[model samples]
Target: MEKYSTNAINADAPVMLATERLLLRQWQRRDLGPFADMNADPEVMRHFPAPLDTQQSNDLAARLCQLIARDGWGFWAVETRSHAEFIGFVGLRETKPDMPFGSCIEIGWRLAQAHWGKGYATEAARRALSFGFEVLALEEIVSFTALPNLRSQAVMQKLGMHRAPDDFDHPAVPQGHALRRHCLYRLARGAWQEQQP
Candidate 1:
């Protein structure tokens, strides 16, 4: 999936956004270790099919980096302002056309196990949503996770995304896999603006 050329505000520059406590910036080489460690943690990977090995994690990171480099925005690496510690990643990405919701940009996050419950996901997501609407002028953004991933659902709710009525089987997950079923949440630009101060 690719970002639209007509919508991106930073099409030629490296992407970076800041929150009160976090910095959402381009992924760095130093981020791979922490990123892989986070991916390897079973507790953190519990919602997915399985934990990613080091090579898988590094490969994923490289793709994310390339997307940001190409489109000027993707799932940016999130770090702290005070500590500059790489907690994880949070940002927007384009979903494949075949995804349950069809082609659209979606918000996503993955944080280190140690960083759970710190409001980092919500804070960084809020900024990402703002960029999606204000900067990219997107019409909508959606998020989804396995049916059992209520933690991620909570973050979606925090961002004012309403649960879609139907559940769908994620094609990417193998048939009969426990994580195959997913719930979707969406927020439209008009609704998002109404929710803002």
Candidate 2:
């Protein structure tokens, strides 16, 4: 028997998620400056090819907003509840269709280096996953990262996603790049349910 029904993708929800210390919401103009700075941080962009310039970071943030405006949900802007500061993004992105696993939606995050050890990624991600598996009623949500990105991989494991056996080369990464090879992790709705209290 199929473990989960196919009724996924709720038209609403995921617009905004508020956790104990964070809020995930649509992008705002105030977020751009800090976002650009964060993207420019070499340590923050360590797994990627290089840090983003201001123009590139702004363009990327704009694109994320456009996606949210169209789909009602995406890698929403993350901020702190106490200070109400723009941190970074944490949510989902739909991968390309031709990949080995086919087109899949993945949960991901990026925050300022200052916020690294506070469990912000994990906390915000839990809300995102709740939005994905519960609000959207998705069958599965996957997360992937460069082979050396142990920090992101750690978040995925904390979310209870299992590491899949078949690792794949990322199409976006240039050939022979150290980060081209990626690790995949997945979480099924049925499995997420088992994790519930």
TM-score, candidate 1, is 0.96
List runs of model 1 lying over 4 Å from the truth.
Answer: 1-8
Candidate 1, residues 34-84, lDDT tens digits: the string is 999999999999999999999999999999999998888999999999999
- The alpha-carbon deviation from the true structure for residue 78 of candidate 2, after best TM-score superposition, in angstroms, is 0.3
- Residue 37 of model 1 has an lDDT of 94
Candidate 2 global TM-score: 0.93
Cα-based RMSD of the predictions, in order?
A: 1.8, 2.9
**Model 2: pairs clashing at backbone N, Cα or C within 3 Å:** none
lDDT of each: 0.93, 0.89
Give the top-scoring candidate (lDDT): 1
The residue-by-residue lDDT of candidate 2 on 64-161, one tens digit each, is 99888767788999999999999899998787886778887899999999999999999999998888877667799999999999999999999999
Error of 2 at 85 (Å): 0.6
* Each prediction's TM-score versus the true structure: 0.96, 0.93
